[model samples]
Target: MKRYLQYGFTTFADHYGSSEILYGQFRKGLLASAMPTTPRPIGATKWCVFRSPPTPYSRKYVEEAVRERMSRTLSDGIDILQFHWQDYDDPRYMDVIQHLLDIKRDGKLRIDELGLVNFDSRRVDEICRTFGSGALVTNQVQFSLVDTRPLYGMASVCAKHQIKLVTYGTLCGGFLADKWLNKPQPDPYFDSLTPSQRKYLDVILGAWGGWELFQTLLSVLRAIGDRHNGLSISNVAVRWVLDHQFVAAVIVGARLGVAEHKDDNAHVFGLRLSQQDRVDVASVLADRTDKI
Candidate 1:
């Protein structure tokens, strides 16, 4: 399970201090060296193992791609190669899965497990069911306090298939923290926002009961953090998600070379949410939020 790895840029120095598990949208050779291999991912980017099945849908394409990435990545093998199907309309994803599994069975590709990225509940059900359970073990998705859609459906689907969710955006692009607490709502049109801040800002304004209510949620989180030996708003937010049984891990965002949160985030490791903490967080959600 990968969690607390918030590095936007990766460096040996930054990587050394970051979470043991490495992840993200790859930048070619950045992750090719100096790492303890766990279940590292490859699907989000096109260069992953299976460099992407090219046109013609041939197994050789997949085989060669897998070998190419494996050669570039860990010499022994990739612990788990995660796959992302960009176009469900294209049935070739099945061919990719088949090729990867077939290569693994042949003991050449050396992928121990196959996970997924951003697949919906229905498709996850279908993939596991069609591929005969255990085909995929984890599905990465945008899940957090602001976006709880997974709880209604993804949670049950994962339970049925015995799959766990690898969650990103758990901190709502760093919005659910003490820094944003009681701050005036920034003008979306005029203000500068990072890609993540912009995305979650929309969620906060349109769906999560707007800026005013979001402030309320942040205040509650701050209070909860104070209760927990003065933990930061971030620690409380991350803990809330970790408290859920279905989530295998929550990925927090970070700026590798520019900034590091290893010390700050370390607090979340053993943090446990009390019943009252849950209730306080829930109260904010109950009173002010769309069904999302």
Candidate 2:
């Protein structure tokens, strides 16, 4: 999906040469004329798309904002649009979504589906109930062993409304990998961790019971991986998220040429946690008191 959307081809001049289905597109003009040499392949998937427009209280501005995005997305042959709103207390999200529904109803836009990102359970339920189940397709959120807050309330709402979860942060910003397994915790003031690393590290130390407990969790994951033909801890971490029935997909961040995990990632499909593996992981998790 990244290759086709970003470069307009399935394979680019990169070290990792593998082919996968293009299921979704996140940005507009990713296939625009800037890279005209690579036209979209014939019969490429009309992506389930995502965009974030500034929140506006007026229904008129909301419609205008979405329409502008729709024009760009349609130009790229996309049919679905997902939204991200930060302040739910604004109460204008419903109006914006309602405008989107009206545009779809009026046949003014080509959006075949609408979805949400970072929306809580209550709002998701209200939207589905207000617009009907068919109105929204999925809700994107952070879900992983380290961040299981969704399981408490969001998962139940999704299961009840049949809204699929598109999860991100499953790898805890790359901290759930072999590189950090037995390493000492970094000094936040001096370490050169990326913004993503620093953010998830806080989750690990603050929400996930600090470095000692995190090390214990990593040990259990490593042991589990050893039984599965020396799979990496990252693979096991991702598979744990996929093991959930409510998860439609796990979003792993990629740095096109800088780094690639395509080879190790394929192993996730083949590695399934045994009943004993689940038990061991659960044992470690049971000690955590943080909801996130």
Candidate 3:
């Protein structure tokens, strides 16, 4: 997987146990807003970064932050720099984004693309209108079959602005995969689930229907996988997201040096869903997206 292909090397939004992975909840103040960006590990393949800068927003601060991130990349410059900002009430995030875009325009550090991380539909629209079209390239957000919030309204905003969605959680932290199919819901109070699992379980119960509905969804995905040359549920899920025209890419999470699904992940491109496949998945997803 390392030796070939056009895919960019991606990383997790946060270390699995960290609360920052709860990207959508910052508006409610559910998690810390501005933790230090996770350092890119030595020898890591880095294409994009997820960073949230705390205010007082200034050009010096933004430049220094962008420089620090670029210095960590293996090349002289980074391919994609994705910005995350909490405190939507502040309104100075526009200044910060402007500064980053200025740096990219300067071309000294070679920031090939600029994007937003976890900004919602309304914010995306506002930013795009403020910056005018084509100023930024993408927005990274959580979009899995189990959590269709992005599809609810995010997709339309991206289409209108000509921005692509670089999505994470397409696997729902791996719950949407086959290993969890037919499995009973784990008790969060017990050790049956990791912190990430516990986090996504909240999404599963809230944004999706409850456990039984999730199981039914999983069964549908498994059957869909079978229809496409016995592809795994993971492949089926990735395929579903890629099938969306507004989705520029899907960011699958993995722990570096521990495990990687490069081979299985690549198979997603080989499978294509039929019209019936979409209906079956949609049947289980019926009315669940209303909460999102």
Expressed as tens digits, the lDDT of each residue in 238-273 for candidate 3 is 888889999988877776446577778878766878
Per-residue lDDT of candidate 1, residues 1-292 (tens digit): 1232332212211122222223322423335544664333333212222334456657787777666555544345666566777777777777777787887778865777677877889888988888777777788788888988899899999888889887889888788888899899987778877888998998998977999999999999988888889999998888888778889777666675565577778888878898999988888889765867
Q: Candidate 1: worst 10 consecutive residues by lDDT?
A: 7-16
Better of 1 and 2 by TM-score: 1
Q: How many backbone clashes does candidate 1 have?
A: 1
Cα distance off (Å), candidate 2, residue 78: 2.8
On residues 1-292, what C-alpha lDDT tens digit does candidate 2 reach at each position? 4453334234221111221111212233344435665544322111122443555456576566565553433443324466777776677678778887777677654556676788899999999988887788778788988999888998888888888887888998888998888899987779988898899888888978888888988999999999999999999999998888888777677775676677777788688899999999999999886867
lDDT score at residue 150, model 2, on the 0-100 scale: 86
* Model 2 clash tally, residue pairs: 0
